[model samples]
Target: MSTAELRYANQFEIIRSEEKDRYLISQLSQQLDELYTKLFGLNNFHIYQPYLHRLSELLYYLTTTLSNRQTIGEEYVCLIQYDPITKRIPSLMRRLFMIFFRIFGDLISKYFLTTFLIRPIAEDFFHPKLSLQTIELITRFIITSIERTHKISFYLTGYYYNISKILTRIRYLIYSRSTSESIEIQSNMNKTIKLLSLCLCIQHIIETYTSLKQVALSISQHRNQLNLIAEEEKEKEKKIVSEDITSSTDYVRCPLCYELAISNVALVPECGHVFCWQCIHTWVAENQTCPLCKTNTTQSRIVHLINY
Candidate 1:
């Protein structure tokens, strides 16, 4: 087989292994549902009991969807049943729960999987059998994945909090603007205006929140695709490094210069490749050439470096 084909095969194997690891971690997180149920039962008596039950149902549905061939449409139907408009309570509560479900789904898939599943697999990939250079490359890939996931979560959480805050503010606005007039007509007008303001707020909140969420989700999805490609590349590098370590090759090649390592002096980039400073400085001066790929560097850009 061709070298590229061999590399591709190794990467596919790695991805499959990572997927299995993620599935196991997801199973473990499911165990937390019982604890969440107990806590809800103890602290939240009546109103939140239904919400807790719904959460459990959602979790069960998700597990089944992941583990087996079960369709989640039925579970979605169960969720929709929670949509009820009662007398005094705001109808917006139903909308709130819908948004909550979406947010929860995102968290379970992204943050929960990354933290519990991918992390351990990544750590294993960097263990003692791996050389320093291979370990550094894998570590850099893992860290980038983590930071991207974190930023996405932060944006999502902030969006929800902002929605909740807007709701609270609308409630306050209505309450504050309410006047107690003995006249029925005036009271009716005030009530109408209050309701109108609330409706407007709800509309604005939903529109703005949806727009922000779409942007964040799009960015996250794109980054995830890039990460998958990066993961495949890293796996290929790992195999090459492993082969080099076992071979009778004498001089350690400077990744930047692609020549014999002259100096014990090596500089590590934020991306974790170590090379002779001379090679690195020359590459940096020209533009950032990733010691390995000669990929253009943005180390001089403060914001890019800090954000990365």
Candidate 2:
């Protein structure tokens, strides 16, 4: 074999069939990992739950807005995700209504007290038991106390009360708008990435399958050749007639083991000569050069040993 052919054979000499299959399997695993990471990263159920909650909140706001019959008065229409109602309401207005109603109910008591400061005092004055200055002072004190109590009760509960302030509400709204838009954009991007990953993963599977198929076919052919050689060897043993006559089998025995190994397999380095399978396999494992010829083996002619 020329230097170029020898170099070419060396490529196959190092990576036997088994190692190549392992390489393909490992590479397929890597492609699978890349595909999974792209498809499922943070875009899965863990993050979807928040959006579900947001949708529920939005639904509640729409329902409440449409039910305000006093304001809508049977002359309005609302359409939310195909659910049609005869009420006109926008998303922003619904958000405001929800913020107020959702927060106020939790913080304040659920009672409409009819008792007023003037009711008890009026009865006292009617009986001439109170002076005008005393009533005036008492009324102012009661009004002040009611206002303080309402504010203090709301703060003590710690039930999302921070948004009640004007600046906080504005900040909350801005944050919510940006966050919603970002979530939507991220969700879209995740979908696109997942689609692309699926395509690549399928392509990788096809390629890996092709590689494995070729390897399997090669292995099958090699086994068939070994079987045929074994049958021939058995026949030769059965007919040991002319001991002096030369035969083709005499040339194929391994110089190392000096006996016919499985298939009487042989390797032909660049020298265009043959050596036993055991001999050449070991020789090549240690060194690429042919033992006798000291040249790169030419695979073009060395491949067929069942006939040799």
Quality of model 1 by C-alpha lDDT: 0.44
Alpha carbon lDDT of residue 27, candidate 2?
55
Clashing pairs in 2: 76-86, 76-87, 77-87, 265-277, 269-297, 270-297
Residue range with the least summed lDDT across 10 consecutive positions in model 1: 1-10
Query: Per-residue lDDT tens digits of candidate 1, residues 1-308?
Result: 11211111111222243355346545544555456666664455555645555565456545543333222332322211111224232345444454354435444445555556545664674222323333333344444444444333323222211232232221110111222442355456456645654665566556556655554464455556667878999999999997776463343466655665533435444555655556666667776657565555654521211211
Model 1 TM: 0.20
lDDT of 2 by residue, 1-308 (tens): 11211111111111232244335445544554455557776456555544444444434434543354211211121112111132333345444644465446322322222124444644654322334444444444444444444333333331222233221221110011235565577567556645654665566556556655654464455556667878999878766644423354576656676775446676573565677766676677677667776787533435446755
lDDT of each: 0.44, 0.44
Q: Estimate each model's TM-score.
A: 0.20, 0.21
